[model samples]
Target chain A: MSTRGQLLLLWTTPVAGVLFLAAYLMFPGFSPPMSPTMTPEEVAAFLQANLTATRGVVIFVNLIGASLVPFFACIAVQMLRVGNSSPVFAYSYIICVGIGLTAFILADYCWGVAAYRPDRDPQLVSLLNDMAWFFFIAPAGLVVVQNLCLAGSIYLDARPKPVFPRWVAHFNVATAVLMIPGAFAILHKAGPLAWDGSLSFSLRLATFAVYVAVMFFVLLRVVQQPVESEGVLL
Target chain B: MAITTADAEPLPDTNGNTTAPGLVPGEASMWFFILGDLLIFGVYFVCYMVYRGEHAGLFLQSQRHLDQGIGMSNTVVLLTSSLFVALGTEAARAGKAARATRLVGIAFACGAVFPILKLVEWLPKLGAGITPGENLFFMFYYLMTGLHLVHVLLGLVILGFVLRSLRSASTPNMKFIETGGIYWHMVDLLWLLLFALFYLIR
Candidate 1:
């Protein structure tokens, strides 16, 4: 593949990230996430109040996973250069991306169902909303495993000139560790472990954003260098 | 990868005492991990303190339920384990692979006691229906300690690798041994902070 083409794929990550955040902000109750403790009637009312914008956000949110595919593929492209004799890590990276993207797609559809009929029973709508947020935040394990695979591949790269810097591997592990608090979101309704809480929501989001930025910049360096003799397999 | 002379060479300090030249005592990459891990945990500590300040009474009440005895016991266990690791690293440096292997084996044995004690501390409370959902304090307690436990478990695995290298390699990877020691010590240090915050703080 042309380096120019790979760079284009790399750019999709930030584009998708920014668009997702924009869609999130377009929805009224999501910036400060809707509290898990919010009553069913309150959740239903909030959805009813912003019904049209909610649908718009849902549509954009659903498209995010598709837009992010190119970026993930690009990551795997770089993983191909990690010098492991077997291409298992690159394959593992793609598998993880599929799982992670499926989670977001499922989460988006939950929101869509919640807004499908604003006049639906408040309890059901609230349940779907709960499902949406749970699907959104609680699947930190997916990202954790994904990054660990990437980090492991980089760490095991025997080449003196590794595709990704050694510190990036450490950074990836640290990012994975930070995401773990989100796994416990299922156990709390309030405080820092809830879907709406600081450690689970804010910290994870920040870490993820920073992770994307770091990966983007590093991948940029990868694509800019003259194509090595060991070309990308894909 | 073999240890480089730059990492193995001894140098004199300002006081003229010769010391190992690897000032950071491991791969620089491992130090990066240690610092990043510390920063992440530091954030959690700050968050815990803020929440504790908001609900001092509830936190105080919840904290009293924690078993100080087990907490202190685990602290001693980890400290002893860390001491062995330090001695093990020194022995590895002095070219005593067999002795180093023994010391690290002892460290692993001591480190293994930590999870057992954690289960002992946790099982009764869980049986009594206390869980992360009981209150914010318990939530932080379980979450932080659980995270720390993972570190301990991972440290044990690293120590295992260190032992394997010591036993099998013709020239032991001193840098690898030192890196494992650094990680084990960090695990020990985090547990001490956890013990103080969860058990001793009033």
Candidate 2:
């Protein structure tokens, strides 16, 4: 692929994140997540009312979010170019990002299924809603692992001048560690640990979005450099 | 490229002793991880305090279930381990390779006691039907401590690598040793906060 094509592919990483956020906004996900305390009937009513919007937005979410595969693949390719070390870190990053992106797409499908037949049993609808939210947030640790892989690769780069700066590697590792607390969302219903709570959902999403943006710019700069001078400057 | 050569070469002191100067011990990247890790923990701590304030009664009641004795002893163990690690890092810096290895080995042994004591404290409480599911306080306690336990386990692995590097290399990789030391100290610092929040807090 041409260098421009490759850089465009990498840009998909942040674009996908933004698309997901837009989809979330369309579906009112920014409000406190659907509480477990809601009765089946209440959940069913909510789904029935938002059926069209939820289905349309999730379909778009699934399509755009799949772009993450190519995005992360580009990252793996760049990582390989910067170092002669084992390809393990780069490969693991691609694998984890692949799995994480798949989970995200599947989560949208789960939501789609919930909105498909609102006339169905309310309890089943509630169950599917629960499934969608849990599946969306729980696998966050995989993304964490993916970040760690990238960070490790950057840190181990033997080039006299590494493609990514040392601080970026540190940022990636820190972001990975920050993502862990979100897993506790499964254990709570109303508190900050809840799926919609500030720590689990808000802060996590904010950090992830910021991370994607930062990395997108960093990688963009790296790609813009001449092929021969790739690692010569940050 | 300029910085790389400078980093690779040790500087000579006036006394003719050569050492890397003004270099943050460990991989510079590790300090980033350490600072960010602490910030993450800080957020959790703030959340804990907010919840504790909101549900002071339940938090206090749950705090009673924690065994202060075990918690205190674990604190001592981790602090002592951290001391040994600090001493070991100094030894490595001084080029006493064998001594650094032995001191870090001792640190590793001390760190190994932590999980055992954690299990001792947890098993009885778990057997008594107290779990993260019991209430909010227990949930926070388990989640935070569980995450710290993961860090401790990882620290042990890092320490193993540090020991291996010390033993295998004629001159130990100061960066690797310092990185491990910083990580272990972060682990120690985290436990101290956890001890205060979970065990001694009102």
Cα TM-score per model: 0.52, 0.51
After superposing candidate 1, which stretches have Cα over 4 Å from the reference?
B1-202
lDDT of 1 at A4: 76
Model 2 Cα displacement at B123 (Å)?
A: 57
Write one digit per residue (lDDT tens) for candidate 2, span B1-202: 1111121356654532234545666676667789999999999999999999999999999999999999999999999999999999999999999999999999999999999999999999999999999999999999999999999999999999999999999988777788899999999999999999999987
Candidate 1, TM-score vs. the true structure? 0.52
DockQ of 1: 0.01
Best by DockQ: 2
In model 2, the Cα lDDT at residue B40 comes to 96
- Estimate, for each residue in A118-160, the C-alpha lDDT of model 2 and write its tens digit: 7799989888888887788856889889898888888888988
Q: Candidate 2: which docking quality band?
A: incorrect
- Which residue pairs of candidate 1 clash? none
For every model shown, the clashing-pair count is 0, 1
User: What is the C-alpha lDDT profile of model 1 across A112-222, one tens digit per residue?
Assistant: 998998789999999999888877874588889888989999999987788888998999899999999988888999999988899988899889888888888888987
TM-score of 2: 0.51
Candidate 2 deviant stretches above 4 angstroms: A13-18, A228-234, B1-202
